[model samples]
Target: MAGSAEGFKEFATSCSGRLFRTAWLLTGDWHLAEDLVQETLGKVYRAWTKRSRPDDPVAYARTTLVRTFITHRRRRGSAERPSDALPDLPAGETDVALRVTLIDTLARLDAKDRAVLVLRYWEDRSVDETAAELGLSAGAVRSRSFRALDRLRAVLGTDGLTPTTQNEVS
Candidate 1:
């Protein structure tokens, strides 16, 4: 698969789950996350056919996912709604409550802030990488990251997911 020019199916198959997790973090809606993943894959597939392969396809997919999510958020009709859609958990999982609270807090954030936080923290990208993906200055990304974390701390502080637990999740 490594040498195949038609390797996008393999690439997409391997990376789509990771892409969907980031998308879900960004959008906080199951259906929207799936749509965002499909769109990111479509873009990657086009690039895979028409251009040279990315040196780092995982990074490329994550950038595409973040940009697509921000683009979708810019549309007037693309507002996120909580769905009954929940990720399937393993049996006897006790951490669902914290996860739910965290996602709900994330969903309350502004779109760009949420993007910044997801890329910088959840994906563990460097400041420069996150700024590049979101098309922001390094200073801007830094500012947003600080403020977004503050917002998360504020909301999650009162929502039973404290700073320590949140840090662990991060």
Candidate 2:
């Protein structure tokens, strides 16, 4: 088995990008995203050094990310207020409009709802996996998923998901 320190360094270097993206989606703030990833990686490294290392480090790290996000949201004075100003995206990014709209809609949801959407659709995890990660029952995961999708559709409106030109419609 690889030394825990070496293994963690390798894992963090290789997986940081994807983990950052997930954290960004969960936190809805670039700064918070970076902080979340750092905190999660620290937790993952500590767990990796333990006697019983997780069989799947990536999955464990992902779970840690979600759990950390949830815990952070639950702490006093941690609730974030929505800002009127939008952050600038990088140049030459594809589908900027759509991305902004989706992020805006996601920002409207509470932390747990946002987490459910990201984990289920973005991470492509099963109901059971999401349930376990969020510390909810499978039934609760399904109910939350349904409610989250409905909220998204309601908020997105016709202009958000629909094509402007009829010819583009499938």
Cα lDDT of model 1 by residue, 1-170, tens digit:
23354577788888899899899988778988999999999887777775466788889889999999989889998765558989787555356677787788889999999999888877889999999999999999999988887887787675554555655566
C-alpha root-mean-square deviation, each candidate: 20.0, 19.9
Model 1, poorest ten-residue lDDT window?
A: 158-167
- What TM-score does model 1 achieve against the real structure? 0.44
Compose the digit string of candidate 2's lDDT tens values, residues 1-170: 43368878999999999999999998889998899999999999988888888899999999999999999899997886779999897555356566676778889998988888788876779989999999989998889888987787787664555434211211
Model number with the top TM-score: 2
Q: Please give each candidate's TM-score.
A: 0.44, 0.46
In the predicted model 1, the residue pairs found to clash are none
Model 1 Cα displacement at 120 (Å)?
A: 57
